[model samples]
Target: MIVVGAGPVGLTAALLLARRGHDVQVLERRTLPSELPRAVHLDAEAQRVLVDAGVDFAALSSPGAGLRLLDADHRVLAEFPREPGAAGMFHQPDLEEQLRAALARAGGQLTTGVGVVAVRPVRGGAQVVTDRSGDPVLAADLVLGCDGAGSTVARAVRPRYRELARPDRWYVVDLLAPAPLPVWPGVHQVCDPVRAATFMPVVGLRYRAEFRVTDQPLDLPAELARFGAQDCTVVREAEYEYGARVARRWRTGRVLLCGDAAHLTPPFIGQGLGLGLRDAHQLAWRVDAVLAGAHDALLDGFGRERAAHARALVRLAAFTGWLMTAGGVRAARVRSGLARLLPSTLLAAGTPPLRPGPWVRRPRVGRGHGVGRLVPDVRVRGRRLDDLLGPGWALLVCSTEVPDLPELPGGARARVLHRGALPDLGPALRDRWVLVRPDRVVAAVGPRAQR
Candidate 1:
């Protein structure tokens, strides 16, 4: 299999596929990994997906925290705790390094300094032509377009899909703060009539600021001054404002698209990267299953499931953008009234609040299947489920009479836990038998008698 793009989403998809024992090749145009911070947040769901892909979040830099919304004066309009299990402010470069390392450990092949010029479907496979030196043609049974918004693969599949146009434009500037500011660790948004600014603390004292420019031509110096900053050194800057858009179809024959190549959205909700990660996880499993002789119909579910999730995210992002960028007299009144009426906790309650910790354990049962799902990571009988599972199958025996059901065949491993031993298990595991997948999703839940 050939995957295009080496960003986090692309590398992640490659790693998952490689772990499933596929011969995966990752192609990228960049000669090296990026050093600048692009994305500022990773929600709980995305972090779980990374952990399941073999990433060690605990070992990375401490997560950035909380969300603070403010008006043009920098007065707090509302503050919300970042969702539980979400990553606050780690550098994008650092996160990408971790992902790249995981991909390496998983034995995936990564080709840098290579650009895919075009992709087309062939009999039982796809052919990709790249500008990398040496061989210009790469062949694989399947092609995955993980390339960003301007995706060549998506262009190739244009006849089968349509691209939606976004409505606005935004710019992001990453900086290395000479010193720490009084700003909170979480996200801070400063809203105004003509423009807005967003502050994100990456790691330590460094930070990233995103500015929404109303007019086409932007004055960087003036914008920086408006945000109450001066003499700040810029690390990177890029334009982002665009309305949400997605392909009509994700797959056309052996070639498919994932991540930004398949969809694009404003960063208002911070769901852009998270959605991309989900795309990787969803497609990886189905691709592996298909390669393993699973029915092709299983592949059909990828677009359906992802499209459902993406649509919701798109709407959420659009709503957030509209609220933050509201203008005119009525908008001003609405914004001011909301600022006065809501307390910080009430504003934040809509999203999961942040917790204090370097590593927050998620709840799980049995093994493999429960890892990715949201469960309190607690111990039963002095053993944490995460410690016991180690990326494998888990079996929870709630009944005294452990069913005479057959053990997992082949190399699969299983764990047995008594429901009576832990009171907490009563709620999450009511059934006598529960089977968890490697990623900690519940595969099967049932009574021992039924089994």
Candidate 2:
């Protein structure tokens, strides 16, 4: 398999594919990881991806308290507190370095400084033509374009995509904290109409602030001073424009797009990284199954499932951006009032549920709620639920006896849990069994186990 773009998403996909016994070569334009921070957040779902990919985050990340939306006067508008299994904040380079190491450890080939220039479909697969910058012509059974928004691979395969919205530009500043501040450990969305901004403390002694600014360049240090960050070391200062967009199609023959190559979202909701990682997670297993002789139709639903997810998140961020960065004082007031009335679950990160799809198979015996959602990790027999489930598909049975089930696409196991092991499983699994995918998504729920 040829995986384009060595960012987190691409590296992750390659690592997982290689782990599944496929040969993967990752191509990247940059020779090294970015010295400055890029993505600063990853929820538990992403943490799950990292664990599945064998990228350790214990040394790279810390828990975040979620987000706080505040008015221009620094008054709270809506606060989304981090739940028990919510996201974590980490340094992008640290996480990327770990991913690179894991890929190497998994025996996946990583070719840096080579950019994919063109992709052409061949007899049974696709050929990825690359720039002569590093590697040469590569042919593989599959091609995954995990490249960013300005994806050359995406353009080579398909020229057009739907632009969801016009971009909003913001100046981003990353500073090495000279010392700690008294601020809480979370993102502060300061909804100042004159200069809306976001501030957060990432892993390491790093602090980042992004401000909505005019096109004119300003003294970067002066801007940091305004944030009372003058004493800190400046890591990087640059302007970034973020908007909503999704490719008209994610798959063309054996070539497919993932991550920013498929969609782009404003940073308002902090889902940009999570969404991409989720893409890699959702696609890798299916690709492996197809390679292992499952029908190619197994992959037919990949683009649709991911496109809908990307659209939902982009729309959510767009709405959040309007409340925090755009609109007038009257709009802000109305938003504040609504925020007060909204439930914390609605406001919190990782609250949205994925809709049912071909991949998210649900049993017909019961309502089978939570079938499409990522299953929460719970303790089982003194070990983490995931640790007990191991890898691949798994069946968690609430009843005393484990039922015989048809073989899943990937091999699966049945683990009978103690009656009260998962209190949060709720009535969804009462007198039933839950089938979990390799990525730990609840694939199905039924009275008698089936796949």
Best by TM-score: 2
For model 2, state the Cα shift of residue 415 in Å: 7.2
lDDT of 1: 0.69
Model 1 stretches astray by more than 4 angstroms? 132-134, 159-166, 216-228, 339-397, 400-439, 442-451
Error of 2 at 283 (Å): 0.8
Could you give candidate 2's per-residue lDDT for residues 128-213 as a string of tens digits? 88778455678889999988888877865683677777788898988888788667788888877667878888876899989888
lDDT of each: 0.69, 0.78
lDDT of 1 by residue, 1-451 (tens): 9999988899888888888788999999999898867766676567767777888765654564666778767777766675544454467778889988888888999989899999988977899999966889988998989998889888776724333334676788887767776667677777676567787777776777887767656677876665544567888888865758766788877788888888877777777787898788767766765776655565666676566567656766776666776676567557856755444432232233122111112334442322223344457568655556555556667666655544442335566766556545435455446655454545455533343
RMSD to true structure for each model, in Å: 6.4, 3.1
Which stretches of model 2 miss by more than 4 angstroms?
Answer: 133-135, 215-227, 333-335, 346-351, 363-366, 400-407, 410-424, 448-451
